[model samples]
Structures are given as structure tokens and as C-alpha cells.
Target chain A: MPGSTLLHIDGVEKRFGGFVAVDGLSLEVKAGEFFALLGPSGCGKTTLLRMLAGFETPDCGRILLDGTDIAGVLPHRRPVNMMFQSYALFPHLNVSDNIAFGLKRAGMARDEIATRVAEMIALGRLEGLERRKPNQLSGGQQQRVALARALALRPRLLLLDEPLGALDKKLRDSTQRELMDLQRRLGTSFIIVTHDQDEAMTMADRIGVMNHGRLVQVATPRQLYEQPASRWVAEFVGDVNIFEGRIERREDQRLVIACHNTGAIVAAAPRQSLAGEAVCVAIRPEKMKLSRQGPAEAAIQAGAINRLEGTVSNLGYLGDISSYGIALDAGATLRVSVTNTARVDVDDFRPGERVVVWFEPDDCVVLDP
Target chain B: MSTRQLFTRPARRAAIAPYLWMVLFFLLPFAFVAKIALSQSALAQPPYLPTFDLTAGWEALKAAAATLSLDNFRLIFSDELYANSYLRSLLVAATSTTLLLLLGYPVAYAIARLPERWQPIAMVLVIIPFWTSFLIRVYAWINILQHDGLLNQVLMALHVISAPLVWLSTDSAMYIGIIYSYLPFMILPLYASLAKLQPSLLEAAQDLGASPAKSFWLVTFPLSLPGVGAGVLLCFIPIVGEFVIPDLLAGSGDMMIGQTLWLEFFANKDWPLAAAIAVMLLGILLVPLLVYEHIQRRQLEGKQ
Candidate 1:
């Protein structure tokens, strides 16, 4: 079950009047996988999730759950549950009753429903707050009750619509980890939609970056960060300095590009084919380093390495790293980050100081325009 | 300045204005009625014995109070006509309120679920009947309910009835008038509450595997209870003391308390006994309100 496809969305499209909310999007979610649909607001991540949960029917699509088309099934008749972003807990029901709602609806025996409610309450670590109404509980406790309620029926695939969106920063972090653990133990597939990139990276096994109602790229979080599919995907996932360039040379395992401002740049391996000479070379700030002088002459033999000479234009002393904005000679500004490895503020780089920024070729991502 | 002078003094006056108005208009009149209920009927101008004289001072007032007794109350309690009217008034009020709820709830729910642009227009339709004068509407109902009237003609045309049905001077006609008049009062509050309900709550219920009917019972109805209570109290209280429709439509076989009071006060000119009946009817109406308040307090206590 873990390896098999549980939910197969084939060319799902939803339109509101003239505006397309979900384009012709197709995807497969493996059973027991922690998948995240990551995007900005109104990017159709929420609309796609709603379609899976039977809240919205697609204009054209086949939603196959274990090889049965369930697109026309009523929401109450479907074996799917969604944890709403607002939690949407029944305000009148107490914690125990909220957890037992789905179970009782399924016509479970009274004793069995009580036992499942108790188990879910304990699973959420809400021991003493059983009788409290949803309004009476704190925000964190209310979220747990919502989660417990959604999980009560053991749905084939649980949908979470930004479930931790209401919690504060500190609670959000811990809850994310707890949610990961719970999903792993339950072994029920989960597809969580969120606009926060960090939350998806922290909890999802794989991430799908969506834009304009279509999935731009889907990959493991590390792959999405280290090897993005396009310039937009690279820039959207994390902070990156993208330089306009054209392919200068192509080899078996590596390619070299000549940037208009920074000059020649070599990439060890490019994921996409050389669709055109015009492309974007992207590098994360932390992957490159800064120093007062250039590297030793032995580095010149390695043709894939890059070296840029610039004066530091701006510097930010964050607690863990110092970011330097370099004003390149050709008028292109590049951002480079250096990790703070020493206790004291040593290796001080300040604004208006001359510096050499350098990085290896593999640290760079070659993205198509 | 202190809080009392700067803040609370003005605020306190504004808050006390309604109570002061009630004391002058309501409590004082009730006191006069209570006095009349206790006094004996008389052949004099005021129709009650031992009227207090201000010029005669404290001694005369004391003598007037001593003459007041519970004799009118005893007489009304012993009479079958008064007893039957009270029961009939309560039963008609309760049944009409129930019918209003059953008929009005779905219409309110539909209006609330309408698109935002249509809701205000639909609500105006509900309130439009109130523009016509109430007496004119009741008179129109008389025409519709009479023999060979519009209702019988329609029924005959549809072949639903073999002949003209006897509708006038019956409980059915009385209920029809009361419900038609009070439907707006029932619908407005129910719509207000139902519209305030989050659409997501119903979706959440369905996602949790509740069928449409079950979701209404579990989520929609429970949350709209405050509206139900308000609507019930609003329509039931006034309908219990209703006079116009009942007197115009209901048969002479049974009478409501309002008819009894009118007859006792105007026909027989027994002001003391009529006042006593009015006081007792008010006491009976207070029972439901007291019960509603008790339940409200217990719910609050349960929450805390």
C-alpha cells in the first residue's frame, strides 16, 4: 500500500465562470506518502485539495481511488476527510463528541465510538480537556481536536488545508513535527496544502510547487531546492541569484555558460536539455563564500569554478550568517552568504570593502528560462 | 473628575431611562389594574368600590385599601366560561406558533442560502405583507373563508371538494389569519441566525460523514436555536393575547381570554372581574419566559 498509488488525479480542471481555478492538472499520490502542494495564495493548491475531498467536482477529470472513479460521489459517502484551515470544529460539541462525530456517522457501535474517541483524544495528548467545548479550548488544543476528529474514521487519504496556519511560530514548528510522526504511524496518505515553503519542506516527503493553476515542478524538497526545473521554480523555492546567460560549451557531464555581466560560468551537470543558448544560471547565497583575497593559483585549473571580484555594497549580520551584497564591476549586484563559524565577530566583512566571491560549479543550478 | 462623575453618571442616566419609562407607563398602570382586581364592582362612575380620594389624606386611603379583597379572583376561578377561555387561548397560541415554525423555517433557510445579491430582495418579499393594514387583511380573509368564497370556488374548480366547505367561524380560519399575520416575525429572526452560520460548519459535518438530513439536525438546527427561541417568544406572547382575528373568525362555541375580558368589562361592566382575568392571563404567560430564563442560566453555568 505504501508504494502503490492511492489517489490518481487525471487531468482535473475546475472553472469558476471564466476564471480557471484548477487547470488540466494530473498527479499521483502514493499511499502513505506525506505530500505537499506548495504555492502562493490563489495558485489553485486549495482548489485542487478541495476537489480531492469531494467539496468541488472537476469540470473534466477522473479521480481514481484504488482504481475506482469517485468524482461523482457525495462528500458524506466518500471515504475522505479534510481538516479545514479554520479547524471548523463544531462549536456546540465538546472535545470527545467532536472526535466521535465521524465514527457515529459511520454507524459504529456506541461502545466502539466511545473507545475510538478516547483513543483519538489520547493520541492528540488531550487528556483532561475531554468535556471542554471547542471555544473553551486554547488555539493549540482546538487544532488537536480538529486533527483527531478528521482522523477518527481512518480515511484512505487525509486532506489537511493549512491545518497549522492558526498557531504561533513556536507552536507551528512543534506541531509540524508531531504531525509528521502521526502520519508515519498511521500510514494513511496525507496531502497538505500550504503557501508556506518552509512548512512544506519540514513536513512533506515530496513537494509540488504550483503557479497559475498548474504544477510547475514536483520533487523531493532537497531536489526541488538543489535542482529546480526552471528559473521561476529556482527563485520561488528559496533565495537565489539568477544571472542571464547563454551556453558557451557542452560536454558529456558538464556545460559552460557565458553570462552577460559576470562572464563565463561552468555547471558540472545541467538537468534540462539545452533548449536554447539563452538561460539563467542560479546559485543559492549560502553555497557561495566571501573572502578578502582570491583563492590560490591551483583553483584556476578547475575550469568549472567561478570567481568574481567586487566590493561589498551591503552587509547584514544575521545571528547565524552574514550576508554580503556585492556590486559586480558590470553593475550586476550578487548576494553571497557566509556562515558565522566563530564566536567572535571575526573575518569581518563590511560595506565598501573589496572582496572576492567564489563558489564551485556544482553548487550552481542551470535553469531554463 | 472621578469615574462616577465623568463616565458613569451620564451612562447611568442613559441606562435608567428605559426602566423609568417602563415604571411610568407599565408598572404604574399594572398597579392600578391590580387594585381594581382586588376591589368589588360598584354602581358608581369608576365601576369599582372604595376609590381613593387624595384630598381625604392617609385615613381615606387606608379605608379604600381595607375595602379591596380577593372576591373577584374567587368568582372568576369558579366560573367555567373564564376557565375555558384561558385554556382555549393558550392552546390556539401554541398550535399556531408551531405551525408558523414548520412553515417558516424552510423559507428562511432558502433565503439565507441564496446568493448575496438575492437575499435582500427575498427578505423584502417576506416583509411586504406588513405594508397592508392588519384589519384590512383580516377582512380580506373573511371574504376568502366565507361560503361560496374564493377558497371554495378554487377548491370546486380543482375538484378537491364536492361542495363549499364550512371554513368561516372555525378554528382553521382563525389559525390561517394568525399564522399569515405572524409569519414575518418568525422568518426574520430565523434568517438572521441561519445566515450568520458558517457554511464551512455544514461542509465539515458532511466531510465527517453526516448525511444532509443528519447535518441539518446536528449542526444547522442546534446553532439556530437562539433564533428559534426569539421567534417563538416574539410570536407566542402576542398571539396569546390576540383579540381581532379570534373574535372575527372563531365560532361562538368557545371564547379566548381576550373575548372574555371584553365581555366582562364592556358588556356586563364588571371592571373588577375583567381586571382579575387580565392579571391571571399575564401570570400564565410568564411561565414559559421563566422556564426559558432558567435553561439559559443553566447553559451558561455548564459552560463555565
Candidate 2:
């Protein structure tokens, strides 16, 4: 659950010449939420973030910060700061001065500026580097400096543009955790714009997936992965096997989907749907189990389990899990991943082997086609 | 070693070739001038005493060395004309360079901020003036600035002035010529520095609560210092020793170092005196050149 809304973005639209960068988009960001705008490049996540920071004016819309419309306000006057994707630290100034820039501009006393600079240096753990210019710092250190500089003014909202884009895998992992801690400690609303789904999932309180120029879905990371609103969102968040079908019947909590190639597939349709309605059955690869024995001989739950006969076409060993691609006799390919809980296996599945892939009806998600 | 590694050795050697050329064409001539500055003037074929005589014995070589003196340097220092000419040259060059910067900076900034496709076209426009000979360009200015020329005619027609302004054959005319001739020198480096600046930096500055004007001062200007220094050096150095513009436009009344050096060498046939003047000019120019070099080295070190 989110707190009281702090930013009310209503029908904001931006266009660069003829290309619409951000279509009519409306969203509400909670006061202390660490929200992420996740999308592929050119999906307008960055343009939306820039609008919030006041670097770009929307073609038509009102963005209310705490109920006050700040449409005409300049970026400098707006109570928002952004950490650029390139960090954009002032190359000429030392780390301490860079952090102190905003404070000094606000007419803070020299002593006060120094004290605030010291506090930021401590917060960023940039000790002994106060006098070093931006170029003198390492990439990770530069990122921290940028973060510290953005946080110094204590803006109502902090916009981060791909904050961890420049870091290596090892550094990015630790930095993501650190950023979450910082945002939580400060209680400032954060809007991170990134294309990395895993980064958004690991750090954000809620993720807003964008496509083309509009927000497709906004949900918590778990909900976004488990119950994506559409097929595009499902495939974008994580690996999912899609079974295109039409609703044959809705019985109790199960939806009997008449899939073309696989004949019939049962999915747990959260929403009530009429018979013959077009829908897609989305099942995560990890939810499906692979066995050499058929469902009837294996004695899997009769009506609750959805089973398909297929031959293993390919397999990938990912240390923690083994993913197998199964080509069904009905002319559909489905992927199933099994956890490698134990090294020794009773039956090790390989390519060209006959297998039965099974998943419970509860594990299936039915989305509108 | 691999074939590629073997190739790098010769490439490294080849890189030193330009430095050798600089030593030969630039340093050797300066050394000759310096040697002449220390020698006495004579009516000989070379027109200076104490030539390096290999045919002469050790005793004659020593005698020739004895002929070398600092009299020409002393003469230059003692004469008010030579001293004032150096000062006047500095004043004109400094003023012209300052004017060029004030005029060129905005043009360069505008070009740098032009759309990506238009940037190269605008840069070519700036360099297009350079296609014509520098002398011809300066002469074109004279046609416009002359009392009965296009400028006075426009001023009169517009009722801006009743009398024709004596625009030519003055220090102001010389300044116009110097600025017009050296503007490309100022613009090119400035454009390069400004073009390399990431737009994100300015955006970040504004995001950090600095207004547009403040951002320009706090971020943009400071980052463009390298270009400013480079453009200043490019214009200032040559203008300090500038001859043609001042000679043609400003007349011979205000004698800069170049014209003085020419008169000393050609008119007075005082080779040693001219060499002494050249050495003094070099000495004066060294301070800024060395400062520029120091800045460049520091920038390189910062990058590393």
C-alpha cells in the first residue's frame, strides 16, 4: 500500500516534432515511494522523468506537486532534482564544492555550506576525496558523488536517470541495495528511470512499465511478475511461455482454454470471462515441472493439472536451474525450468527425450489477447 | 613479437619525425637569429660579424667569438622608440584579441548549439572566409571603412552622421582588420570545446537549482576555459607580431614590432638590431606560450 499522493501528473503529453515521446499519461506517486519507470529505450520513460524534473515542458498537461500546479515553473525553481544517466558532475569543481553548489546558490552561509558539504561527504563515504575533481574519482565513486549532490538540497522528489547504468555487475548489485537504503532513510519520493527490469524489480517499491509513449501497467514487483496485465508486460518482466487460446468455458476457479495446437489448456483466470472470449494463457517456465512419466501414470491431480506431451528439443544448464525447450506434437513449443535442488537426479532430461510437462491451474495466468 | 607489435616500433619512430622537423625548421632558424643578435654589425656579405668559421684556426675562432657582444640588445633597451614599439604592439594585439573574443564567443556558442546536421555546415561557413587570402580580406575592409566608401554612404543616407568619418588610416581601422582576419582562429577552438560539452551537464546544473544564466556561469563557462585559452593564444601570438594590417590600415605612425623589425632588417640594414628586436619579442611572447603549454599539460594530466 502506498502513502498519500505527492505528485499528481495529469494527462501529460510531450512531442518532439512529429514523434510523440510521451502520450497522454496520468499517474500519482506516493510521498515516500521508490517508484521506477521501466521501459525499453525510446519508450518515453526518460521524457516523463525530465518533465517531472522541469527540464522539459509537456505539450499539454498539468503536473501538480503537492496540489500546486508547477507547469510553468523552471527546473531551478521546482523542488525537484535529477541525477543524470551520465552523472553530469561538474568536472571543474571538486567533490565537496560540487555537493555544496546548491547550498551555496540558496545563499547559505559559508560555514553552513561547509557543514552540509561535510555531511554529504560522510553520507557518500567520500572521505579524503573532498578536494578531488570529478575526473579524479572512479565510476562508482562518481555515481556516489552524483547521488550525494542530488540529495544535498533535500528536494521533495529525486529523479534518477539510469543511476546504475555505468556500473559493472558486481558494483551495480551492491549499489542498488545502497540506493534503496538511502531513499528509505531520507524518505524522499524517488523516480528511477531505467531499462533494466531486474534493477527495477530489486530496488523499486512499485514499477511502472512503459511502452511506446504510455504507461502499460503499474504494480509492485511481485504482482508485476506474477500477474502482468498483458502479454507484452508478461514477456518483458521475465521469461514466460504463452499459450494462445480462446475461453471454452469458465468452471469454478478454472478457465478451460481451447488452445489451437495443444487442444485444451486450463488456467486460473482471476477475472470472470465469457465463453469463446479470446485470451492468452501465460505460465512462467519455473512453474512447469518435467517428468518422463505421463500425468495419468504419475497420478498428478486429474482436473487441477494441465499436461502436455512433448519431446525435449533443447536444454540449458544455468547452475541453479535447468531450462528445457519442449516441442509438442501439436506443433507448439513450451519451455519448462526445474530447480537443481540436488546434483543427483532420478531422471536427467536431455534433448530428443519424450517428456510430459505439467503445471497446476493456479500457476497459469490468463491475459486478454 | 607478433607482426603488429613489430609494426608499432617503427610507428613510434615515425611519430618523432615531426619533432625533428620542428627542431630543424623552427628551432635552428631561431638559434641563428639569437646568434646574430649577440654579434656586431658589419659590412660583410652576411652583414654580421662573428660567423662560425671552420676554415679559420682555433686562434681566429676565439677572435671571432670575442667579436660577439650584447651591444645590440643594449641599444634596443636604451632607445625609447624600440621600447615604445614593443609596448604599442602589445596594446594593439591585446585590444584586438579582446574584441575578437567578445565577438567570436557568441558566434561559436550558437554554432555549437546548432542542430547536429547544421553544425558542420555552420563550421564550414566560419572557415569559408579563410578560403580567400588574408590580405585580400583585410583590403576588403578598407573599401568599406574609407571616408567616401560604403559605410560612410550608408551612415549619411540613414542620417546617423552628417560628416564622413575618417575611418581608414587609423588605429581603429587596424583593430577592425586584425579582428576580421583572426576571427576564425578564435571561433574554431571555441566551437571544438563547446561542441564536446555534453548537454547533460547544463541540464544537471539546472536540475541542481541553478538558473540558466547561473548555469552558464557556474558550469558552461568554466568547462570552456581550455577553448578560451587556446583561442586567445591563437589570436594573440600572431597579432603581437602582426605587420600587414597595421602597416596598411593604421599607416606607419604607430609602428608595431613587426614593422619595426622589417624596417630594422630591410630599410636600416641593421640585421643584428632586428635580430635583437626579434629575440626580445620572442622573450615577451614566451610567458603566455609557456602558460598555455602548462594549461594543456595539466588538462592532459587531469584526463589521465
Query: Where is the poorest 10-residue window by lDDT in model 1 chain A?
Result: A296-305
lDDT of 2 by residue, A152-202 (tens): 998889999999999999999999999999998889999999999999999
Give lDDT per model, in order: 0.91, 0.91
DockQ of each: 0.62, 0.76
lDDT, model 2, position B129 = 91
lDDT of 2 by residue, B1-304 (tens): 4546766787978978999999999999999999999987889889988798888889988888888899999999899999899999999989988999999999999999899999999999989998899888888988999989998999999999999999899898898889888999999999999999999999888888888999999998888899999999999999999999998899668699999999999998889999999999999999999999998899787766
True-structure Cα RMSD, model 2: 2.6
Q: Give the TM-score of candidate 1.
A: 0.93
Report the Cα lDDT for candidate 1.
0.91
lDDT (C-alpha) at residue A126 in model 2: 99
Expressed between 0 and 1, the share of native interface contacts present in candidate 2 is: 0.80
TM-score, predicted candidate 2 vs. hidden true structure: 0.96
Of the true interface contacts, each candidate retains a share of 0.76, 0.80
Candidate 2: where is the Cα deviation over 4 Å? A272-276, A294-301, A344-347, B1-8, B56-59
